[model samples]
Target: MMNHPVSPNAPTASRAIGPTEFRAAMGQFASGLTVVASLDASGNPVGLACQSFSSLSLDPQLVLVCIGKGSTSWPRIARTGRFSVSILAADQQEVCAALGSRGPDKFQTIPWIATAHGTVRIDGALAAIDCRIHDIYEAGDHLVVIGKVLDLATRQDGDPLLFFRSAFAKGLAA
Candidate 1:
């Protein structure tokens, strides 16, 4: 690698932006929404709307999602050692909102299916990625969960629900 001298005009205050500014800046980049779903000890469903799902390592079939530490649902799902990431379809904003908030009956308001492996999957989602817990790391206000993919399938064909700015968005051009 060739080394180049740092430009004298390089900006140094880029790291000083507040969270609000950072959030607003990040909002310009579109991202797909997903529900991280799992079953509890009694076979009841638990889930949370997660926007941070991404493919990590192709060789080991790994994926990752960052869950907020304040989320009430993640703890229950983490305990199960297995979960499914259901990529929300364009028509599932209600499903996203219901699972995103703190509630005892999130599953009661959403249409979902129970997997044979005991994970919960959203009904009519664009896709489902079932995984086993591989590792976890605490990062500031969130937990970075690494999952080893056991199975995955495309559930339906449609545009995925997206989150931009501070709201849910849909209908991206094909």
Candidate 2:
């Protein structure tokens, strides 16, 4: 076998990875959209749309969501130590767009109800999960927020909203 000579100017894996390239690559993976919400210091609801939620454990019932460090809602949610995850339904694209945007009074145009745990749950969601912050770890540009599930509720029937290739889609086909 012949060995290939390495060029000093050749790009390495790290050097080849840029924000746009990395985002485009990751966008290929389809993910469910969720709105993670909590009450602010003044008892007002605050939340942001997240596509990085995942179930971490079953025995103790745990879930995880990644929040950008620059997100304004994260700080308020962190301070509360409790939050709710609303799994968006197929028709809830408007809800996702609203929450994901940067502005004040995100909840103004959306319908929601507050849980006993002081977190807001979006109406007509596929499912709503209430959790208390279990752990937090720093990931490169975001924080991995692990939550201990407290209570959860599901709609009788509905299709889920999905994100793929940087756009929203209905649930996958059977």
Candidate 3:
């Protein structure tokens, strides 16, 4: 992991990323959009829109998502001990941004319901995986959350939302 800040003394160096280089580099790797959701101890729902979700292993039914260190949703989900991974459909951009915002009211704007484990399960997503936090490790400026899937649900037909070059895209045709 490299720790090169865009500027050493600048307070907002994080915003000064080399966009062209960053986009070009990340564009080479593709990912599906996912909304990582959970309920706080008081049953308040919190979630984040993530493009960094991945399948780590099938044998153990493991999955992982990267959440930034500054994210408000991460801590709440961590406290709850469980979460749900909602694979967004290609048309759910509004839901994505709503959950991706800062502070409270994130759940008020999105449509979801309680999962078997009491975590919030997003409605109309392509799939939803109920998970218990297996491990959370520090990875550069983000936290890599590893989860063991407890329950899984999927729809028969739906196109996934793809994230590439810092924007949303439709999944490729078969």
Top-scoring candidate (lDDT)? 2
> Candidate 1 or 3, higher lDDT?
1
- The whole-model lDDT of each prediction reads 0.91, 0.94, 0.87
lDDT of 3 by residue, 1-174 (tens): 998767666675366669698879978787888899888888788889988889999999999999999997788889889999999998888888787778568777678979879788889999999999999999988999999999999999988878877777766668
lDDT tens digits, residue span 1-174, model 1: 999998999976767789999899988888999999999999899999999999999999999999999988898999999999999998999999888888779888788888887899898999999999999999999999999999888954688898888788865679
Q: Which sections of candidate 3 miss by over 4 Å? A: 1-20
lDDT of 1: 0.91
Query: What lDDT tens digits, residue by residue, belong to model 2 across residues 10-80?
Result: 87765567989989999999999999999888999999999999999998999999999999989998999
> What would the TM-score be for candidate 3 when compared with the true structure?
0.84
**In model 1, what lDDT does residue 94 have?**
93
Pull out the clashing pairs in model 2. none
Q: What TM-score do all the candidates reach, one by one?
A: 0.90, 0.90, 0.84
**TM-score, model 2 to reference:** 0.90
Cα displacement (Å) at residue 44, model 2:
0.7
